[model samples]
Target: MSAAQDPGTPPRPHAMLIAQITDPHIGLQPGPATGPLDPTGSLRRALAHVRALQPAVDVLLLTGDLADSGRPQDYAEIATLLADTLPTPADGGPRVLAVPGNHDRRAPARQALAAAMPVAPDAPGDCVCLHVEHGGLHLIGLDTVVPGAAHGALAAEQLAWLQRHLTACAGAPVLIFMHHPPLISGMAAMDACGLLQGRAELGRIVAAHGGVQAIAAGHLHRAIVGQLGGAPVVVAPSSSHQLTLDLRPDAPLALRFEPPMIGLYRWTAADGIACHFSYVEAFGPSHPI
Candidate 1:
């Protein structure tokens, strides 16, 4: 694909709401593992905020950091909670989407969400991709989980799959989802977990393809959106608890009950994409109708 468009032609952007929910640190207890975090409880509250949105959302994307530990049971817990709580077409709401993060154990996560897992059981690999078309828009979810590492990387296999999908889409506008950020944000300490090992190769793949509208990710426990090698990247905040960024090793365990955040990304065939964020408060500001 060429960088500059020919005269009389302009880059086209797809319009759709891709709701990104990240880092709902499940199974977090109030003790050492969680460091005074209430992951399960917090996620419940956050869901309430999401349920009350005025305009409603189209697609639901969970950005990862799924379980506190990479245990099979933790994954089961996530599957159960998500099925009951999150919005979906069956429940008169948006269809749910997800990708695995560092905290997510690929094996168990794959077993439970068999639909999303790449190769089926007895297959050599595990990964899943979804194609959703809503109002002249398409969204795709990609898996980027690597076993036994604080850092994140997208494998050659996954990239190959992404390439094929983008090629198939042709001119259709698309949004890519993953567990790790393809790029980094500020805050030195948290940046360690932000690296994608084969990023250069991934860039070339995206460079070769022109349909990707934006890339959204989860990790870092903070809200950030920026450009990566010419692509838009948005990082969603965790619903469970946030990792306070303090480069100092000696700083006290800095965890707090900052209300978890949820997003409302609005897209219109005429207007392109826009986003808004709000927290899980006890009771939202009152209004007169």
Candidate 2:
């Protein structure tokens, strides 16, 4: 794809709002009242907040780890909760886009989710292509789910498909959402379980494509920002449980009692992309950010 822009047709300024929630781990039973692992309540409240947004979010892109165990019941709960939270097409309900995490089983995801959710456009119907034009900004969902493994990988077919779609845009503003980060975070443990195998190849594809205005991810269960191929890359905070950020492996398995929060991303062609690591009014802030 030519990296040139058309000065005359000047890229139209756009403002788009996306509500991103990641690593809900929604199926796990809340830990004892004394503990902070209230996946169910946190998720419930988080969804409520998303619903109550004044302008209404144009889309809800879940970055994965939807289930605690990839269980059928867990996905069922997610489907039902989402059914209540998501808007009706008549009322201009926010478009819902989701990809599986290490904890999610694609088969169960298929069974539990309603057929209405959009699939990936270029792939077969099994893989969803969720494309939404929110305030003129395009948000594209990519699947990096690899079952029975903690790691994630984008198959060659998917990578080629992504290149094609991104190139076709011809410099149009775009955002890509996926389950795993293509680059490593500082945490060594996470790096071991993050995107696997095709790092260099993926970077080449992304760097070569100029339309990726920004890229969003989930899986790390933290709100992280870094660069991948010169585009802004964001990782959403987990809703159900927290990943202990302690870079030291000697650190205890830390899951704090903080109330759930979701990451909100605002993207525009005019001012570029801005992010808010926002929490619902009822939640507390205990992390050392």
- Per TM-score, the best of the predicted structures is 2
Model 1 ranges with Cα > 4 A deviation: 1-15, 32-36, 86-88, 115-124, 129-131, 245-254, 286-289
lDDT of 1 by residue, 16-97 (tens): 4556678886776577654657777777666656666655655677777778676788778767776677655655565566
What would the per-residue lDDT of candidate 2 be over residues 1-289, giving only the tens digit for each residue? 2222212322335456788888888767764642656677777778888888766676788888888898899888888888887775457666667877788887788688744345654563355445544455666677777767898887787777667767776667788888888877877778778888666676787788766777888888777888778787888778876677877755544565554567787766777778777776654646896
lDDT of 2 at 120: 52
RMSD per prediction, one decimal?
6.3, 5.5
lDDT of each: 0.65, 0.72
What does candidate 1 score on TM?
Answer: 0.81
Clashing pairs in 1: 116-128, 117-127, 118-127
Model 2 TM: 0.84
Compute each candidate's TM-score over C-alphas: 0.81, 0.84
Q: Which stretches of candidate 2 lie over 4 Å from their true place?
A: 1-14, 30-34, 124-134, 249-253, 283-289
Please state the error at residue 163 of candidate 2 in Å: 0.8
Clashing pairs in 2: 36-257, 119-128, 119-129, 120-128, 120-129, 121-129
